[model samples]
Target: MDRTAHGLTSLRNGVKTLPLAPMRDNSEIRTLIDRVLPVVDEWREHLTVSIGRATELTGLKDTQIRYFEELYRQDRDPAASSGVTRSYSLTDLRRLAVFAELLKEGYRPAQAAEIVRSFADAIDYGAAYTVADALRREGDAITDGFLLSRLASQVIFAAQREIGERLPDARIIAMFLVERRIDGVSAEEFVDIARDIATHPQNVLVAVDRAAVIGNESDSSESVWSDDESSIVLFYSRDPWSVPVPDRAQFCYYRPPSTPDATVVFMVESAGYRSIPPELTVKTSARDHLLDWMVRMCLSIFPEFRQATRAHNYRYRSDGYRLAHTRQSLTRLMHRVRDLIFGDDADVSVACLLLPDDLYKPMYLSILAHAGYPEARARQARLMLYGEGEGLSGRAFNAREPFLTLDAEQDLRVFGAQDERCKVALAAPLLSHWDTHPFGVLYLASQRPASPLWSETAFVALVFGNILSELLGRWWLTRLRRKHDNLLHRYVAEYIRWFNGMDMHGPEFNEGLQQIERIWERIAVTSASSGNVRTVVERLSRQYVTLVVLDIDRSRQLHSRGDEPFLLAAQRHVHQAIAQILPDVRGYWFKNDHTLLVLDGYAPEEAIVLIRRIAGRVQMVPVVIEGRTERTTVTISAALKSLSYQELYDLSHHDREVLRSSLMTIIDTIYEQTRGCERTIKVFQHGVWEKV
Candidate 1:
């Protein structure tokens, strides 16, 4: 997985180690133009010289062509005035060329129009809705061409969305064009890509429900129940070698009854035979970009925001206060008081007094008068919530040093008042850009008295307030820059997901590249581009040198041994042996109670020795697989030159057949020789020849 491992070893090395294409620039735009001009010239008649010419050739009325042209034109420029004679640029021309190719490939004009339109929307919006809308509008405007176009366009859009959702930026989307080998850029191919991406662990891309992260529960009842009772249930039915099954995250506890109804009851089930279960497809597929953003917000941006919000609500409840009203009033009062005190510009401060007009004087008096007590003050704070008449407001000029007050009672003469009843406060000068000395008093107030002791809560609040101010100041300065970077990363990651048709956020880049190679094995890239020979070769070779080792009669014995531990121990021995030799050999397989492999990496003579060693060593001791491993090799080089999946399959089948024949022939020969030896020994015992 090293980044530098796949660098250029030679100029002629056509296989580029799947670098995610960078976002296109002006030069790439020019390259696209160069690729499309020739197509345009050849399809000139079908395309027409201008919008007017196209209208004439297609026999469409002026209005129809205008509608089509207008659609294309508007998309070209968002700010352009409608109905202006906006010319089609090279990019537009190239897109038209692709549409023309589809038409020639048998799409009707109307269908072609729909398809082109949908594709345009998908490209422009990066979603499938645009195409869906266009089809809906096509209502009864159907044609063979239109149908083909519609199907093609619809498929492309869906696949693109599927891919784009996984990788959200532009470059990854473009890279998909080059990497994915789906048939004719169709939707099914994209779906296949999406499935692969979803299953591939290296893709690291995950989707989560945003509502769930925000504490919103799923509306479905199944979400709260065990999976067996839910829509999908995980179970084991067949051995791993029997089929290529999707992996599961864990084993199932509730095994369904062995009946056909069981499968119908559970929409999905997963299991493993000689290996561990595979990953869950549905879980991975459900994860998308919004969820990714939520995860980043929670884990990356501010981990404690959600927790703090919850904790604050709990604190309010525990204090016998209605948090909703208290919070609402607090917020409203903060803004209002800020405006009243600071006028046009209000600088944020560590602490400020927020009080209703009616209770201001009473609360202030209670703090400094004979009624001053922590219990009484706390009660008055709650009574203030009940709306009452307003209190008097006054302004004084030429005041001395500013002393803090709870509400309206401003008296600093009695030092004993600074007890639990009247929480102590600090008054620091607020200086702004316009002045150097104190412009206004900045107050810090807490519930704990400062005479001789302070409450634990008050001390904590003091520390918290200081941290908040410093943190907020730093946040204000870097918010814009952080937002920009986050946005860029989001788009790029998404674009790559779209390009690969899978999430690639899980592992580092190199691991993903290896995963991509694994998926590429299952698909065929039809693009006649360079650098695909090695990939094709690797895929074909897998089929040519495949080996299949049949258990012969050991299935029951292994089953009797019981549980995964024993089976795994046996499997590990075989797997380790296979793994060590496969690199030196050509092909290998492990499934069911059989070991099937093909060797093309080594010469025939060398392959013989390697295959024999694998066969002989596998049956060594306590883990007995028929007490002897079978070896078979077929020369596929003559028949499988231009290799393919099907051809590889045929080659493997052919080799297995030949191996079966060899086993039968050996068995028959041994039987015949033993029969003759038995007769000779019986005759010798009866003294037919000399007894020496």
Candidate 2:
């Protein structure tokens, strides 16, 4: 039997299987049949086309038609027996017909499906068996097939409107159907076609979705070849429109068990669809586009630096290296700016003022040559805050304003020979946001008399100057921090080294400690007013000093093979812990095994308890060593000593060994008495110390 006959038999069997409610009279049944017969007849006339006929009419292969057929059938009856064949309706055929046409017009399968669905939803077929009847009822038909064509036109127009609204540059091009395993066309050929289309300046975008062949190793038996395998839709568009297209297309596909290769139904532009005007698409202006590109380029070169809070009192001394790096960054930026505003042919020179020590005294940064002038001549240019200088740069710096001169030789006096060679000169002060005075002045000069300096040129110069000002400010702040850190480190080093050579019996012992104390006090008053340094210094000076020596118990267990980083990290962890727990504590690394913490202002008993607490906290936390986390256990011994001038003066005459022995005896006795006691703390009072 023919496929249609088989479908009819299935429909009959399906109807017979339906459960019927008990009816009171035959009239009710007749009334129901009268009402439903027209709709059923309509479906038969439009939707009852065999799968073979569907391929012939819609230009979709058999497999492609089956894909859509299965999608609709499954959607309508998800739990129906899987092996049974289902019938396709006119609704499904109409949607497929529209989708095929859209694919030919260069719409992706998914996009075409969306358009077809929207068209189907928008049309009202009330009581009409055919599209022609529907059009007649709406009074839209002018002649034979005219209404159908017009309806197609309306659907296409709506689809175009949707595409145009969402994607401005994309328009219908062309689409058609193909076989997944055609004789001459291979996957590589399809890829090449896509590449060729993409290369076109106007063809900005391209997309292709292929059907997976049934017999292919990649295909699984469990795969439902419904919306997944029918159509391969491709879309292409011009430049900006060529950006990645949105994935909104919805096309159906099905792979029959008997078919080897999946049917690839596609769409491309043809003569039927109306042409879209090129003017309707958005086109960015060249100037705006260029400016955008320039901004992106600038940002890539100089990313904005985010300043983190200062966590440690240490700074790197790399001023020379930092200055060189800053110069390189500024030079590249200057060249970019010059190329942007003044063309390469123009005799442009750019230089920045250094302002080494004070802002008022400006020196040459010497990054770029001064406007086709020798580097030495540029270096010679300098400015004073109040002095009357011959150079235009000096005048600009004094006035704190941009200075522009048409005749450099006549208007300027400093750098006499060099000024005579330049016809145009422009100087703009590099003003910083964070500072009251300008950091430096940016100078630009052109030797060519033909190149006129416009007002816009001056504006560009000012802008470049401001950018340099901000960058310079960051560099200056970094320099100041390093200088401050170096000074602090120097004083601390001097104090520590000075103690090693001191004799307790000498008169200078008391005087030397007092002098170091005074220096620390001056630093606290002058520089570190309220930060970590100030807190540390105040604590050290105000209270009796307690020395707590912490020795890592299992230091020998640390990995010996390239374990430097692990050891350093462990040390940092300990230091950070102590600093967090006791903000006023000052400590130093002694040898490689231990750290000596100087806790100030605490009595002997209080000092011992504080040290015990610090040790406990450190031991409880785990540290990562050799890629493994291990608890840090340490043995601690502490001794408290007073640094009073009178006590030190009396002890100055005592033997050095006796003084050291007395202090050691006190610490050893305390450790012995309270080795593991939690509540009781061993504190060496003056009486206990004297007895020792």
Candidate 3:
């Protein structure tokens, strides 16, 4: 009876705040009917809800409403209006929203009313035509789209059978005795309780079965029906209830689902007891009321307990489901809010805005595909974000990334965008906290135009869209970092391969260098250009790498920094870090103090990480030195041709630096990258690269 018990004041206030419509004439109705019918026809099946809601919320007067009523009239008795109240369901609210849409679009009350009437007529025709067409094709069998028809029919029949069996018992014995003129007031009251229990007779049967099972039908054995020894004696009796005296002895219960497997007992005595009155009396009636209360308590509390148990199980076995459930819950709440205010016909879409134009092209062309956005459309949207003049079409205006209806009339002016065909749009601002210029934007769009139902669906989607955009941005950031790290690895591997010819401890060094080289090659091939995959590799290699083996004053101390896997991988870090750190040393193009370059061709501006790491480790303070050396590889090639390690090791420290720098330069040179004006660089002294 009270379908709208909550939010009455809020709904009333919202309606009061809305602008009123102007007067309407015949011409306005004709124009609206024509414009609306086409869109409605195009979306006959999917757009039914929008069409219906638009008709309802349009604020038509009684006379205007009568115009529509003539088309779908049913035989009604004059007496039907007596003491009846008209209550609108959610469906009715949707119809009202649709009417509001028509009115808000400049159609006057009368005109909008007439247009809705015509629209309803068209809808009726479309449904009838489709149904007839379908019937004409199929033979004898009907092809209705009701999925659960048979199951529902069977359930209804079974319910009717059970109700049929119980009705006679109540009518003959219970009703006759209670309704008898000689029966006292107490007897009449007992009949009322029986009627309430009979309202849902199946539930009564279940309560009876549960109470009997818990009592074990007079069995006192602790084992009862259980095979396991993990049993405990527990009381399962009717909780307190407002039952009269005669039936007070009929309370019963069994083991509740919330507690562990156990035997039932009396609540007051805390011992095994099942009270079943010998004859139908007032004591039995009172006890039955108490028993029903217990049943209700068990039913209500068991779900919460079961949910908690399942949640605990999911935490250990399926963490993904647990996280997904949280997301879904949030989404569901958003949808409910949307449904309450926006009407059920509203739809949602997303728009993404980006700062600085350069990142757009690469991001749209590359990253959009990964996120399941159409690449061509992404590129077009990218162009819109970068291009000047009234921005992309279908982009939202109020909030940069707010969910908005794309009814075209509402959104076109807001976004300041053009050349896009989206009806609804939502935009997410891709503002980077660290970068002065944002990376780029991620947006979502829907082709379907807005209707009232869109309120709930769009609200859910908006929340989901914002979440998705954040995730995408984070993913992009992580991806960019990984790409840079991988590039650093490539430069290190190449440097190692080049240095292998200079000094070979045994076959192990050769194999290790070969393996490293292969890995670097793969990284180079797989890495994306946006991540600075190539440039990072070359810069670190050039700055930090000098000789294959440095003349260290204290190798023992450096090695004793604990056996953390990260520290142990310093050998590899020494190789990769040099490739990352070198570019910032002003005019230190050819060499630095820790990284020496003799007569060997080294990579340019790379090899910074390794040099910084080893140099930082040795100097323990800043060591500022710059020098250049001749190409070492030219000489090493000749020594390697003769298979002589002694001749290779004879190479100077400057020569090793040149080789390291040259290897680092190889990766950076493959791609040209301009560093951002506000770039931040970090260097780790004790092999930070290895842990990653």
lDDT of 2 at 159: 33
TM-score of 1: 0.17
Tell me the lDDT of model 1 at 188.
Answer: 44
Among the numbered candidates, top lDDT falls to 2
Residues 64-151, model 3: lDDT tens digits? 4333333223223466596553333333333343455675776544444434554554323322335654444232111211111221
RMSD of 2: 28.5
Q: Which residues of candidate 2, in runs, are more than 4 Å off? A: 1-321, 348-357, 360-371, 376-386, 413-420, 433-435, 450-452, 493-692
**TM-scores for all predictions:** 0.17, 0.27, 0.21
lDDT-best of 2 and 3 = 2
User: Each prediction's Cα RMSD?
Assistant: 30.4, 28.5, 33.5
- Cα lDDT computed for each candidate against the true fold: 0.30, 0.42, 0.31
Q: Model 2 — which ten-residue stretch has the worst lDDT?
A: 303-312
